[model samples]
Target: MCSYGSKLVAPWTIASPISAKICRLRQVAKRFYNFGSKEYKSAFGDAPFFDSQGLRERTIQYIKNFDASIWHKDPIRTIVKGNYFIQGVESDTTNAIGNINGKQIFADKETFEKITAHISSSALRYEVSKCKDLMKAVRRLEADLL
Candidate 1:
């Protein structure tokens, strides 16, 4: 995720040299502060051949079709994290970023679980899904471990 002004923008990283170059350029041009740049890794470095199974495209399509209400009262936010977010990390599920209602919300996995402990599984799923973009980035980070 790149911080554009006060907002965060996440671009799915395709497995290609061109995409890597573009990501590098984004880091320089837009001052996009992603885990890749922070760890001296490019987007490609994080997700080498990630789309080998067409999972990226399929996942995007699935996300588009998946019913947000089935999981929660609100829609899923659709956070897409590339593999770079987890480079060199063993297991980190505590980082979260997104919004709920009009207020900006941020929390880690454990904290999120505790905060919404009272909510039903479906609603919890929706709230977590709402942070899709952040979770996507988190998944990207997890890819580095693979």
Candidate 2:
């Protein structure tokens, strides 16, 4: 022990409030890391979002046509007709103007055309539409799948 005025300080003793707080934090972090090293429940537990097998399959299939180099999995929150869905981002770093519920995905014809344009050229065929039939058909197909 060393004397600082009338107080005797031990080598292992925390000398200040900040050091005491830091020691407590290190103990907590050690416990947390040790617990994490053992088998543990998932961070999200069993959320419904992780259990959607059908939706997962469909999303995978649809995204397979997209150009991986130009687009990545960036979830964007969207609401349509009072319902919410997680959309994606466009190549231009803009929110993809679309919404997909349990049923069909919906967007304006222009948005739909613009997003689909990001499909890999090898897998895509270009079309110039004069009407809304294409988007309607896409919506119908999406609805039928669900």
Candidate 3:
């Protein structure tokens, strides 16, 4: 165990199981996302803003053509609406957005468009607009998804 000033200095250095797991997770995520890589720069940029080729147009068209009635019967609409209630409201990052999976929601143009097409703005307003905590999340998601 590496130590300094009476405290362990390398808990994640394969000595502590818990620390090693956490550190390994971070390593895998950082390597997979390559968040600082120039390849990431070729993507939609650091933020979730739709800055890709023809992506912004597709998102807009999807939102504009999205049918709000789709929320009335489908069980999944509830899921996306639930996401709006907490997404950006709790923080700048989220694990999901509507039917959008946070893990790969932005992976490709098709998935991104599908997510935008499924989001229910009215249901979101009904559920989240009244709550201060959720409104921020709603706003952020709306801006990105819409």
Candidate 4:
């Protein structure tokens, strides 16, 4: 087994010139912070290859997204005044008619959860079956994992 500090470097000194060049390329790639699809580890590696800074940004964003306002109160059962406001195209006609119950009514958290729960699983199945080929690789399989 290789040690942490000298593992890759120690191998580089002993490796052939071609191997050394490959390792050097990997070293440069390891330093990259690109949040793009070109990311890899070994030649045919997986997606979601987060470097140190990318991981840190995601960690901070997770903490920043925590709802402090919800800490004191229970989950909402009815629509609040704040929930009534939906941000969309801002126009005089839209302002007068769209908000404050035009055709559809905004539900509170509890109601929204209940309504979604009824349709969620079926709706997801419908969506997946619609484009089965495109989503085949990532979508969950019926077979057990080895």
Candidate 5:
């Protein structure tokens, strides 16, 4: 009789196809953000504001749109919201994910999910908005997924 080990194999080994597909998508997104099209740059560039309120409004809209577009394909795989900067795991693939002081760290799904849930629930969004650094905030969120 054949005997199997009690330990469960990692999901990556069990679901190579899904893992590979996610990896590919992540790569493409990263490439697009890094060497993005002219339009992307223009959309994110600094703009003279008519007023502080107008600047805030535009920034909020831009951030929401940017986030929605990036996570549109897989909402579950994305960090929809957050408060204080923290790191965690993605729920689906157990990818390591987080943004430490603005740098993204993607590890495993379990870890990413924990961190994502925590930050998403915290006052990170308010704090981030107050800083008015939408690009850094967006980058922190996107880097984890990618």
Candidate 6:
């Protein structure tokens, strides 16, 4: 995701190699702050990954230890904002992809129950078969989840 944001900042016409480098560094830093730390671990809990505040501390230390040039350019805010936007875009894209994949899986009535268990209500379950759009299906699913 950081790499994606870095690539987007390019072709600014006035951007230099140093500027690009800083942009990449800022993107990396934002990821560390956003999702790669103990804060993230505490917020999300452990499962696939181990619980290690040391690892998070080390990551923060590494970013803090970078050359002043990384902070001199101070592209963190822009990169963070761009990262947020990209996350939304990626989320929407994945939702669309899920809808595409689900169409095949939900082709049958019985299968819809398995899928709906996580996201659909009794009313939604009754009406979902009549839903003609992915967004409507998603909304029904979300309503059930809530």
Please give me the total number of clashing residue pairs in predicted model 5: 25
Task: Judge candidate 6 at residue 115 and give its lDDT.
Answer: 40
Q: Candidate 3: lDDT over CA atoms?
A: 0.50
lDDT tens digits, residue span 11-70, model 1: 354456565567668778766555646454533344545554688789889998986444
Candidate 2 off by > 4 Å: 1-13, 34-36, 41-75, 79-146
- Give all TM-scores, in the order shown: 0.22, 0.24, 0.24, 0.20, 0.21, 0.23
Model with the higher TM-score, candidate 1 or 3: 3
Each model's lDDT comes to: 0.45, 0.48, 0.50, 0.46, 0.52, 0.44
* Per-prediction CA RMSD (Å): 19.0, 18.6, 18.7, 17.7, 20.8, 20.6
Candidate 1, position 79, lDDT: 29
lDDT of 5 by residue, 1-146 (tens): 11124554444454467755665666677767845577765657775656889889999998877743334244343343433322444332323564222223344666667666766665355336665457766676565434
- In angstroms, the error of model 6 at 6 is 21
| Model 3 stretches astray by more than 4 angstroms | 1-15, 43-67, 71-146
Clash numbers, per candidate: 18, 0, 3, 0, 25, 0
Best by lDDT: 5
Per-residue lDDT tens digits for candidate 2, residues 49-84, read 455898888899888876544333433334433344
Model 5, residue 143: displacement in angstroms? 38
Quote model 3's TM-score.
0.24
* Regions of model 6 farther than 4 Å from truth: 1-18, 21-28, 45-106, 122-146
lDDT value, candidate 4, whole model = 0.46
The segments of candidate 5 whose C-alpha lies over 4 angstroms from its true place after superposition are: 1-15, 34-46, 52-146
Please write out the lDDT profile of model 6 over residues 33-73, one tens digit for every residue.
Answer: 65656765554434475568988999899888866443323
